[model samples]
Target: QASLADLDILRRTRRMEYFRIVNWDNMLYPQYEDKMQKTIAPDIWKWLQSEAKRKLAEKPVAHPAVRAHWQSIVDGIVPFGYNVVEE
Candidate 1:
């Protein structure tokens, strides 16, 4: 029973290696940004971005300043020079 389990594990490992080799160059990603840029006008995109931000800002948070502070940290920049003061 133990030897059978070991053989099963080995077979699975070999199958995984074969799949990795086969899919080495089979990469794919959606060109959503390119498609949106080509289809949507620049001003429309900007308006969409502002609307999304407004929606995000409307969400309830215990500490709005702290929330924005941490979000700016995650974004690695203080967007629009908006200062976030810690409470």
Candidate 2:
């Protein structure tokens, strides 16, 4: 059986490899962003923005500073599977 440290190293290595494979074109190709941008319809993009804003509005924080900070945290989240990426 692998040791804890060995398993941890393997997990990190595999994660790196997975992202490298998935984002290879985005990393190497300059037109990747342009192509991706073109694929998102304007109406869909607008709807997404509106939905995000509505979701944020639903969770109201009383203080201005707290609200701003909370919004920043919410905006940074990317949903993956059943959970958002912690980082």
Candidate 3:
């Protein structure tokens, strides 16, 4: 159950990771560069800056499951260097 839930969230947010990686000026795989740049990169710069900050500000709540999931979400964006509250 936990694995499925984690995979689902990863599936949803995988594009965000790609955007971060691409913006890092790294050489992304040639196959994905065209589509990622032409299509996804168009609006991702603006959205990623805002949404990534918002996600980092999110705090885990009282419920264990919710906290765990929230941590997973937070972990995905940790590389982007948002100012997360240290727990």
By descending TM-score, how would the candidates be arranged? 2, 1, 3
Question: What lDDT, from 0 to 1, does candidate 1 have?
Answer: 0.46
Which pairs of residues collide in model 1? none
Model 3, 27-57: lDDT tens digits are 4567555434333332444454455446546
Model 1 per-residue lDDT tens digits across residues 1-87: 996676678678776321111232223535443322213334444444554465457755537785665455445454454333332
- Cα deviation of 2, candidate 1, in Å: 80
In model 3, residue pairs whose N, Cα or C atoms come closer than 3 Å (at least 3 residues apart or on different chains), thus clashing, are none
Give a tens-digit lDDT track for model 2, residues 1-87.
Answer: 456566567668776321111345675777776433323334444444465566568857557765665455457432222222122
- Residue 77 shift from truth in candidate 1, angstroms: 17
How do the predictions measure up, each by TM-score?
Answer: 0.26, 0.29, 0.24
Model 2 CA lDDT for position 55: 57
Worst 10 residues of 3 by lDDT: 78-87
lDDT scores of the candidates, listed in order:
0.46, 0.48, 0.48
